[model samples]
Target: MRKSIIAAAFASLAILPAAASGAEEPPHVDYSFAGVFGTFDPVQLQRGFQVYKEVCAACHSLKFVAFRNLGDAGGPHFTEAEVKALAAGYDVAAIDNETGEATTRKGLPSDHIPAPFPNEIAAKAANNGSAPPDLSLMAKAREGNASYIHAILTGYDHPVPEGVQVPEGGNYNPYFPGGVIAMPKPLSDGQVEYADASVPRTVDQYAKDVSAFLMWTAEPKMEVRKRVGFGAILFLGALSVLLYLSYRRVWRNVDH
Candidate 1:
């Protein structure tokens, strides 16, 4: 009995790697905000926000983001008037000062993005027992970050491989863990009409745009941070050279 149990344990352990290996790696994407000197393209970020609002908003939320962030430097960079106008369109929960009661009011720039459902239970009930995750920190939270998100969004185009049994109501996406995802194909060709006539209105473009937007949402200060880091590196490099020269000058007359 002891030998049999040990053998079973080993067999289970062996199966784990095989199951994990079944999922495909997310394909690489050359995003604008990559590498040390990378900076976000304002237009791309704007288009990405549009995709999130029109398509993903129905299911996911950006609870950590605020309307005012749209006007901030290094992001979508919408004007102050545009940000205020956008904020006014959304209804947010607020306290009625006179009555001291909870009430809904027009959103302000300070108000956080709202969830589609009131609570987790409601969200799960609406989405086939799978609550749609908030997209606020999704880029930072996931392993492959933006690439993973882009892959999942576009992965639906591939045909299901043989011997795969997708669960009920779940779509087959090889990039998704377990090869099944609850969310259906959210984008289609020409689904959204872009304001820019040059940009292609297609699923691939939408995926790329939204992925970039999420990355911005996740690390809004990334540009500032990079700039500071580079400045520090430069300062240190210059200091090192100065110190080396000083040491050489001071020790020049001394014997080793």
Candidate 2:
């Protein structure tokens, strides 16, 4: 027992340095949809889309998603016309099939979400040689869930430490892996007028909404998955009761 105590003490000492290494941690946020039964708040998702459109889309892309996805079942559920209007706001490059030449066309619901830059070189040039990642899977890609994402968005105000220097066109974010981020702080309070007047125009509100939207993009079928899982559990529960009854009845006649 004494030897075990000594070993445990040594282990704690070994771990103490890592725990107290002074790396910054992300703040906590309680999301409405997080667990098995959680459902996406469509209104919040819509607001997030607005944030992305007006703000983040300038550098980031949602390349895997189609504009029509916004109108799909279990999504933000924008109407077909609304999706069309949203798509029309951006233009996409297309090849003229008959002429074999490239052409610019109004974005369509069938088209993938367009990137702000035509290619990686343009994106890199605009963003200091580091292109912003496609955000379709960011909510899933980051180890820090919504809270981590929200913290990174809202945690940019900390002043640079006296010994540290931020690179040109770079910004300081404590939550960023290296405490330096290529993307400047993209959100500010009252940055955009929300479609819903009731939604608050604040950095935190924008972060939460956009984080939730990215979560949906990461798992578009979450609602359906949860519903199907619930139905399967109910069916299994009923089947188990029926099977037990059958066993009891059959055994009743054949006493041990």
Candidate 3:
């Protein structure tokens, strides 16, 4: 009896890992800016911004990004004139410096993007008790970066495995945690038309575009960092060469 019990326990342990591994993993994607010298693609970022504005903004918040950042160096680089126009669309709260009164104003380059809901409670009530996490840090926060984001947004609309029950109002997505998520599948073909005829207007295309955009929001200074690093390497290389020549000159005509 003791040996039989031990064998059963060992079998259970072996099966657990296999069950866990059944969860689908995010697919790998070759992002344009992924290496030491990678830079964000401006057009992809812009299309991503459009996707966020039209769809994800209804639930997710980008509170860390500023209106001016849209035009900032090494980011979306939208012209200042364009940023000004974009800011005008969102109203933000302001305090009257002298009168000590609260007021509303058009968003500025400096202003943080406003939350769609007034507070967490409102957001939870709307989304079946799970307030969608803020997207400002999502790219850096997740394990797979843009690939994970793109996978999730495009993972829905497929059939689920047999006997896997999805709770009422909950969605079944193999890529999401526990194979379930509260938010419904948010993308569909032709959901948002792209202004650039060059880019495709499909669900997968939209997912990829927005994933790139979010990566920029999470790491706005990536381009500047790459540029500075490159310059430093050049300077160090020149210095090394000079030192080597100087050593040879100092040892002129001397036998080792």
Each candidate: RMSD to true structure? 4.9, 3.5, 5.5
* C-alpha-based local distance difference test score of model 3: 0.89
Model 1 misplacement above 4 A: 1-21
lDDT of each: 0.92, 0.87, 0.89
**Model 1 lDDT-worst window of ten:** 16-25
Worst 10 residues of 2 by lDDT: 17-26
- Candidate 1 has which clashing residue pairs, if any? none
Give TM-scores for every candidate, taking all chains together and pairing residue i with residue i. 0.90, 0.86, 0.83
**Residue 242 displacement (Å), model 3:** 3.5
Find the number of clashing residue pairs for candidate 1.
Answer: 0
Tell me the tens digit of each residue's lDDT in model 2 across 1-256: 9999999999999877446543466677777787888888888888998998899998899988899999977778899999999999888898998998999889999999888887889999988889998899988887667777798899889998887788888898878777788988899999989877888999999999999899889889989999999999999999999999999998997858
Error of 1 at 42 (Å): 1.2
Top lDDT hit: 1
Model 1 — TM-score against the truth?
0.90
Misplaced by over 4 Å in model 2 are: 1-23, 161-165, 254-256
lDDT of 3 by residue, 1-256 (tens): 9999999999989887547645566888778889998888887898899999999999999999988898876777899899999998889998988898998888887888888898999999999999999999899987788888998998997798898889998998888767888989999989998987877889899999999999999999888889999999999999999999999999988998
| Comparing 1 and 3 on TM-score, the stronger one | 1
